[model samples]
Target: MAGVELLTGRAGASASALALETAATRHPGALTRIALIGNPNSGKTSLFNQLTGLNQKVGNFPGVTVDRKTGVSQLTPQLRAEIIDLPGTYSLYPKSLDEKVITDLLYDRGSAQYPDFVVITADASNLRRNLLLFTQLADLGLPAVLALNMMDVAEQHGVHIDIAALQQELGVPIIPMNARKGIGIAALKIVMAQMLGAPTVHFYEPEDELLPMIRQIRYYFNLHNDYLALHYAHQYRHIGFLSPDDRAYIQELTEKYGFEPTARQAQETIDRYTLINHILLNAVEVTRTERNEPYSNRLDRVLTHKVWGYLIFFAVLFLLFQAVFAWASYPMELIDEGVAWINSLIQTNFNGPLVSLLTEGVLAGLGGVLIFIPQIALLFAFIAVLEETGYMARVTFMMDRIMRKFGLNGKSVVPLISGVACAVPAIMSARTIENWKDRIITIFVTPLMSCSARIPVYTVLIGLVVPDVPVLGIFNLRGVALMGLYLLGFFAAILSAWAMKFLLKTTERSYFIMEFPVYRWPRWKNVGLTIVEKVKTFVFQAGKVILAISILLWVLATYGPPGKQEGAEQQVRTERQRLEQAQPAATHTPTENTFADETERLVASAKLENSYAGMFGHVLEPVIRPLGFDWKIGIALITSFAAREVFVGTISTIYSVGQDATQQTVQQKLSAERDEQGNPFFTPARAMSLLVFYVFAMQCMSTLAATYRETKGWKWPLLQLIYMTGLAYVSSLLVYQAMV
Candidate 1:
C-alpha cells in the first residue's frame, strides 16, 4: 500500500525520490493525501468533517501556534485519501504566525508537508474576497480544483455566478457546493480523482502594466536581498507564490523607483484589487438589494449592550455552570454506578492477586477519571454551540471593555472560557491574542478559572460535607457554595491580571479588532466533531498519567516493610483458630451464631490492621496527624496529583486492599472506618477541610505541562504550581484548624 505524501510545491527530484521510497515501504498504494484551503468561514472544515467523519487528528504546525488537521477519507472503493485542512486566512500574504504556516507549506519553504493536490474552497456568498486567494493559487501553476462552497447561501441571496464561465477564466474545475448540506461532494471527489493524473495548469498571465512593476520589484529584490529574490523566484516558478515578503520587496522597489513605500504598496494592493474587482464584475451579478444590516451588529445590541451585555453574559455563564452540575448529575451518577457494578462483577468472577490488582488498582483508578466525561462533554457542547453561533465573539466584544480596565484584551474571553474545560488548552488558546502583554496576562490568569479537573475533587468534597439546604427560595446551598468557588477563581484571575499590568510595562496598543463572522445555525456535524476531539483528548492525555500513578499506588498499598504480609496472614490464622476453638459443638444455637459473628469480625479486624495498606497508613500517620488527615487520606492526596478524581479511587483501592474481601463496597467500608481513637475518620468538618484543600490545590501535572508550553518557559508554570500548592496548603490548614 502506497501512503500519501504531502508536498507543498513540486518536490525536488531527490526529495520526491525519498518520499516515494518511504511511501512504497510504509504502505504501497494504501493512502491518498489531499489538502483543503479556503478563506476564513468558507465551510471548508464542515466539508472536511463530512468527508473524513471521525478519522482525524489535530496537531500544531512545526514551531507555530496554527493547528494542522489531517484525516483519511475513502473517495472510492479503490482510492483512499488523506485530507489536510489548512489554516483560515484572507490572503496568501502572511501577517501572523498562523498565516505564515500556510504560505510556507504551500511554497515548500517550511517543514510543512505539501499536498498532492489543492482543494480551493471558496464561499459563494463572498466570492470576490475568496477569489482573490483562489486567483493567486491558480497563478502558482499547481494542479488545483475549486470548491464553490455555500452555493445555497448565494442562491438565497439572489447572487448569480456562472460556474462554467468562472472555470474557463480560472482554467480549473469548479464544483458548486453546499458543504453543510453535503451537496456536490460526489462531483468534487470525482474531479479530484480525474485531476490527480492531469498536468499543472496556469490560469492567467500578468498584464503589460503589472509585468513592468513585477520586473522592477524583482530587480530591487535581487539587488538588496539576493537570497530572498532567489527564494521567491523559485517559489513563483513552482508553487503558487504570493507572500508578505513579495509585497515588501515591491514596496522597497517603489522607493527606489521614486515613490513612497506606503503609497506604492497601497497602489499595488489596490491594483490587484482592481484586477480582481474587474474579473468579478464580469463573472458575477447580484440581483438582491445591498443591505447595510450586519447581523453581528444587530445581535450585539442586546448581547453586548453597556449594562445588559455583561449581566446577560454573566447570567449565561452562571446557567452554564449550574447546568454542568444539575443536568450532568444524573448521567454522572449512572456512570459511577455502572463502574461500581463492573468492579463488583469482576471481583465476584475472579479471585487472585492479578485479578485483585486489575479490578481494584487499574479499573477503579481509571473509573474515577472516566466518570467525569459526562460533565466535560456537556461543558464542551455548550461552548461549541456558542462558538458556532457566533455568540462567543460578542462575548469577547462586550468583555473587552471590562477586561481593558485590568489591562487585558477582550480576546482573553476565549481563554478564560476554555479554562473551565481545562487550563492547558485555555493557555494555548491565548496565542490568538496579538498583543504580547495581553497574551501574557491572559496566560497568567487563565489557570484561575475553575477547570473541569477540579470538579471531581469539588464534587466529592461538596457531597461529603455541604448541606443540601435551600439558600433562598430556589437556590441550593451546595450549588451556591460551588458557584462561590468558581467566582473566587474568576476574581483571582482579575486581580492577577491587574497586578501584572502594573509590574510589566509595555506600550503595545490594545485594539479590539475581531471579525464578527455572520451568524449561522450551529452545524451538528461540526459540533459533534468538536465534542469527540475534546473528549478523546481528555481521556488519552489524562488517562496516561492516571494509569501510571494507579500502578505505583497499587505497589505502595500492596507491599509493606519486613515480614508484614506473613505477619498479617499469621494474625488472621490465629484469630480464626481461636474463634473456631471457642465455638462449642453443642452451643451452636441462635446466641452461638451471634458469638461466632463477633469472632469473625475480630479475625477480619486483625487481618486488616496487619495488612499492607494499613501498615503503610500507620507509618504516615505521624506526618498527616496535624492536618486532620490519616495515611489513607495522604495517599489519596498524592494520587489526586495525577487527577483530582483519583481521590475517590485511591480511597476505594486503599480500603479494598486492607479488607481482602473484594465483595465489600467503598461506601460501606468508608462509613464503617474508624481512626486510632475509635472515631469515624470522615467527619463533616474533616470532609469540609479536604474539600477546601482540593478547591485550591495545584495537583494536576498535565495542567502544569500545558501552562509551561503556553508560556514558553518554566517560570510561569513553576510559579503557578508553587503559588497554587501553597495556597491549597494554607487554606486547608486554616480550615482544619478552625474546624477541629
Candidate 2:
C-alpha cells in the first residue's frame, strides 16, 4: 500500500515543500495533524490544552457519541499543525457511541480523513489497564507514540517500569511526564518530530504460541457453525467497529452459532485478561505498599450510606440554592447599576426614535440577559469544585437506590444537578445514561429543576415578600424559603418520575455502572475554562432572543392605535383650558412648560394602555386576575415566557413611565408605583403569588425545544408543558389564597 504522510503543527505554517540534495523537505503547515487518543481520566485533555492552548473549537460528530475537539499548534517555527482530541474509551471495541468515534476516525473505510500518527496517552498510575488500549491501537498498524501521563502520581505511589524495555516490546517511543505540570512536553514534541520524519511502522498479529490455540478455537467454532469463526475474527481485528449495522450482523451470527457464541465471548474475555496480567507482572513493579487512606472512602461511607447519604445530599443542595440567591445579590446589584448608567449615556449621546429603541429596547434587553452571567458563573463554579473533588460520583451512587425507588436511574442525578445551571445542557447531558427508559425520564423531568433563568424572577418576588428574618438561630428565613422552592422542584420531579414508572412500561432492566476515579486536587485551569465556555454560550444564546423581544415590545409601546397620541394631546389641552378658565386672571395663563408636562404624562399613559402588549394583557386579565396579576403584570408574564430573567427587564420598561424621571432601579420604580385603586401593585400577596408562579412555570422555550428533539416527538414536550403549566397555576392559586 502507498503511504501518504501528513504533518502536525501549530496554526499559520507554510503549505509548500522544498527539494533537497537527497530528500524532500515539507514546510511547517504540512505537519498539522495530531490525533489524541487515551483511556478515560488519563489527562488527555490536559495534554490537548498544553498543545493547542487557546486555539480550539468544540463540535459534535456527524451522528456519534463523540465530541470533536480540533485545535492548532505550532510544532516548529516553520510548521503549523492541527490536533484532534478523540473521546476517552477503555478498549476500542466500541461498546458505546463515544468509543466508536475514535475507532471510526482511525480505520473506518468510509472516513475521508485519517491521522498521519496516533498519540496514545496512558495513565502512569494504572499502566496495566491503560496499556491494553495502547496495544490494541498498535495492532491497527498506525505510527504511534506513548505518552506516560501523570508520572508524578506514579512515583508517589512507588510504581516503576523500565521505559526502554517497555518501548522495545511495544515498538514505540515512550515519553514520561506530568501533563498537569507541563513536564516532559518538550521531549514529547521532539519524539513526535522524529517519528513523523521516520518511515512508518506496520504492526500485525504476532506469530506466538497462542496462534495455535487461536486456530484450534477457530477450527472448533467453524466445525460447529460456518460463520462463527469468521465473526469472532472480524470483531477482534476491528478497532472502533460497532454500529447498528454491526449489531444486526452480530445478531444474525449469534442465531446461526447458537449457544457456542456466548461461551466463546466469555472465553475470549478470560483469555485477554490472562495475557494482560502476565505482561503487566513481567514488565512492571510496585515497590511501595498501598496507602490505607481513610479520608475519601470514610467520607463516602456516610455520604453514600443508604440513609444518611440522602440527608447530607439534601443539606448540600439546600446550601447551594441559598448561596445562589444570597451570594449573587451583591454582583447583581452592581450589574443593574452599570446597565442603567450605560442606558443613560446612550440616551444623552443620541436622539430620535432609533436612539430610544436602542437605549430602552435593545440595550436594555441585552443588559437584562447579560446580568445573569454572574449567577451562572457562580453556580457552575461551585459545581466544578464538587466534581473536581470527586464527590459527584458518590452523589450519583448514593442517589441510585432512592432514585430507583422513584423509577429514575441514579445517572439521572447528573442531568438534574446540571439543570440548576441551564436546562439546555442538562437535557443534553441526559445522553450519558445509556438506558432508553432512564434517559427519557431524565430528559422529561430535568427542566423541572429551577434553572438560572428563573433567578431574576425569584429574586424580585422574594425581595418583595419574604421578609428578612433570622431563623433557626443563624440562617435567614428568606433564604430558607428560597431553598424550599428548589426542593419543591426536586420533589416534583421525583413524583412525576414515579408516576411515569407506572404509566410507561418497558422490559429493559436498569443497570448502575460508573467509574470512581482517584481523587486529585482541582485543576483551576480546567475549571476556569469550563466557566468561561458556559457563560459565553448562555450570554450569546439568550441575548439574541431577549434583544428581539425587546425591540418588538418597544415598537408596540411606542406606536399605539391610530389617533391615540392626538387624543391624549387634545385631552391635556382641554384640561389646561378648563383649569385656566376657573382660576383668577392674576394666576397668569398656565405656562407652556406645564402644558408640555401634562401632554407628556397623558401620552405615556395612553401609549401603555393602548399598546399591543397592553391589549394582550387585557385579554389574559380575566384568567390571571384570580392569581392577583394586573394587566401590566400580565404583559410581563407573557414576555417572560421567552426567559424568566426577562421578567425583571419587562417590569423595568413597563414601570419606567412618568416616574420621578431619573431613577433607574426596577425596585425603586416598582416601589413608587400605585394602582387605580391607590394600592401598591407589588403587595406581599401578589409577590408571593408571582414567586410561586415562577417556581413551577415551564417558561423556557429552549428547554421545550430540546425536549422535543431528544424524545424525537412532541408527546413528552407536550406533556411537560401541560403538567408544568397546570402545576404552576394551581400552586400560585394556593399561595395567593393562603397569603391573603
Candidate 3:
C-alpha cells in the first residue's frame, strides 16, 4: 500500500511533492528489496530474468560461496525493486549449504539482505509439493505474494486451478503465470506494488509438547513468529546469525526439555502438508483424460537408454568441441590481427620506455586474454544450452552408476561437468555432496578437468601441433585434438579418484537424489547472458593477473645485472664484424642485408639470455629440459603457476620484446623459434608434452584457495598441489620421451 501511494501523485500531490516524498521515504532512491523463493524448477529464476532483464548481477551471500543473483526491476515508473533470487530448496529445514543460505537470511531479520517482501513461485502442476515450503514461509509471518507458474504445463496435464479461490483459501495474492512465455509478469508486478500485509493465518501450530520451548526461544530471541522460534530450535547450531551465547542457551533449553528437533520437524512437515491438502481441495480440479506416454518420457527412453545414453552424451561433447574450433576461428583471427595492428601502431608512434611497457607488456598480455574470448563464449554458450534444456540432469542420472565405480557419488558428476567451466565454483559446488569422503574426492579431482581457463593454452598448442585438416571428412583434426585433451583430463580425474578411494576411507553411505525437469527449448536470453557474464569474468579477471605479470616480466627481461646486457650486445656486434670481414665480397653482395638482420637478431637474443628472467629460466631449465622445454618455456611454466592461461600471455610478452618490425601473432612467434641446435622448438612431441602437462597440473592458485576454504584445512590443498604437480611432471616426461 505504501509502495502504491509513493508511485502515484496522491491527494492532489504535485509532481515535486511526490519526488520529495519518494526521496525521503526510500533510502535516497533505493530499490525496494524483493526475494524470489521457490522449489527447484518452479520457474522462479525464469521469472526473475523476465523482471530484471539485463540489470542482473551475481555475487556471493555475505561469507558464503553459494551464488547470490540480484537485479533491479522497475515495478512502476517511480518505484524500483531489487530482486534477490534465493537458492531453491524443498523446505526451510536445511540439508545443504544452499538450503542453509535460504533459512539463514529468512530467519535473520537484522540482516541487510532480508527481503521487504517475498515472492513465492509455485508450480501449478505440482501445487501440493511446492506449497510445502510456501506454508513454512507463511508461518514465519512474512508479507508475501504467490506466483502460480507453469499454468500452460498444468493445462496440458489436464489440471486446472481456480486462482481466485486459491488466493482466498490461502489468504494470499496468487497470480497465474507461464514464466517462460512472459505471461502474468505485469499482473505480478501490480500486486507486488500493492503488497499485502503479513499473513494472519497460522499454517502450522507447534504442539503443546514443543510450545514451551518455542515460547522460550521466541522470548529470548525477540522473534515475533512462533515458526521462527521453532526453526531456531531445529537448526540452532547451524544458524549463521546466532551468537555463541544464543546457541548455548538454546542447547541448554533443548536438554532441559528433552526435545528432539528432527522428530519435531518431521511432524511439522506432516502437519503442513495435511493443511495444504485440505486448503487445495476446493481450489483444485483434475480431469482424467486419456493420453499417450508423455513426450519427455518418450524422448528419455532413448536419451537415457543404457548404451545409447553414453554414446549420445559423448557425441554431444564431440560436437560441442567441433563447434568451438570451427566457429571461433574467424573471430579469433580478427582479434589476433586487431591486437597486432594496435601493437604496430603503438610501436611506430611512440619512442620511450613507457610506450614499450604499453605495447609489449600491457597490450601483449591483454591481447592473449582477448583472443580467447570467442572460444570461451562459445564453450559457455553450449554449456548454458545444455543446462537450460534440462538434459544436463539426464547426464547426471546416467553417470551415477559409472561414478560409483570410481569412488564418487552420482552428484560428483555435477562438479566434474561444472569444472569444464572453472574449478573454483566447481570445488565449491561439491558441498552438495553430503558424504565427507565423496565431497573431498570430488574436490581433489575437479581441477584436473580442463577448465575454460586452459582453452587459450590448448587452442594455441593444438594449432601448432595438430593439422587443421578434417578427420573422417567431418571433424577437424585440431578439434579432435582439443577434445582429446579434455578427455585426457577427465579420465585422469576419475582414475585419480579411484586411487584416492583406498587412500582416504569413510564408512558413511552416499545417495544422489535429483529431479528430471521436463525438456524445453533453451532460453536464448539466459544463454546470451551467461555467455556475456562468463566472457567478461575471463577477460577482466585474467586481464588483471596477466597485465601485472607481463609488466613485471618485461622489466626483468629488458634489463640484466649491470653490464651483462650491454656486454652481450657489444659481443654480438664484434662477432658480426668479424664474419663480414672474413666473407668474400661477391658472396656477401646478395646476402649482406640478411647477414646484418641475423646479426641484430643475435644481439637481441643474447641480451635476453642474460636478463634476469632468462637467468632464472636457465636455473630452472635443467630440471625441465628432459621434457623438451627451453628456458623460455621454463619461465612460462613457473609464471603460469599463478594461472594456466597466463602461460599464453607470458609467452606473448616474452616473445614481443626486442623484436623485428614485422608484427607476428603469439603462435607465429612460437613457431619461428629455434633451439641452440638449430632445431625447431615446439615440435609436435614437445607441444603435446606441454598439453599433457597442463591437463593434469594444478596451475591455478585461486582453485587451491577455494579448495582450502572448502576443505577447512591446508592439508588437502597442499596434498593436491604436490600430487597434481608430480602427475604433470611424470606424465609430460613420459610423453616427451616416448615421442622424441
Q: State which candidate has the highest TM-score.
A: 3
Q: Each model's TM-score?
A: 0.71, 0.74, 0.82
Consecutive 10-residue window with the lowest summed lDDT within model 1: 1-10
Off by over 4 Å in 1: 1-32, 59-67, 76-78, 95-97, 109-112, 139-141, 196-268, 288-300, 307-319, 404-447, 450-483, 497-513, 564-633, 642-692, 699-723, 730-740
lDDT of 3 by residue, 185-302 (tens): 9888876765633334557778888889989999998999888998898889988878999999999999999989778877878888888899989999988546655678888999
lDDT of 1 by residue, 1-740 (tens): 00011222354234434544544454455464578988867888888988888999877765554567889887867567789888777766654555567766765522226566689899898888788777667555446778888887787667898776676566667888888778888877666654553445543454354445556655754433222332353234222345676656655554454543344344545666777777677678888565845555677788878888888988888777677667877897888788888889989998899987888678866775676577667777777788788787778777787788997978888678757766655665575576667887887777778887677667656765677899878999889988988887778778878888898876545555666666778988789888887777666755556566666666665665677666766776676567557867675564565554544544444444455655655776786666688776866666566666667766765554334333355555565667779887778778777776776677466666556555556787788878777766777778888888
Worst window of 10 by summed lDDT in candidate 3: 1-10
Instruction: Write the residue-wise lDDT of candidate 2 on 197-224 in tens digits.
Output: 3333433342353344345445643323
What TM-score quantifies how close candidate 2 is to the native fold?
0.74
Q: Candidate 2 deviates by what RMSD?
A: 7.6
Greater lDDT among 1 and 2 belongs to: 2
At residue 59, give the lDDT of candidate 1: 72
Candidate 2, residue 684: Cα displacement in angstroms equals: 9.3
What is the lDDT for 13 in model 2? 16
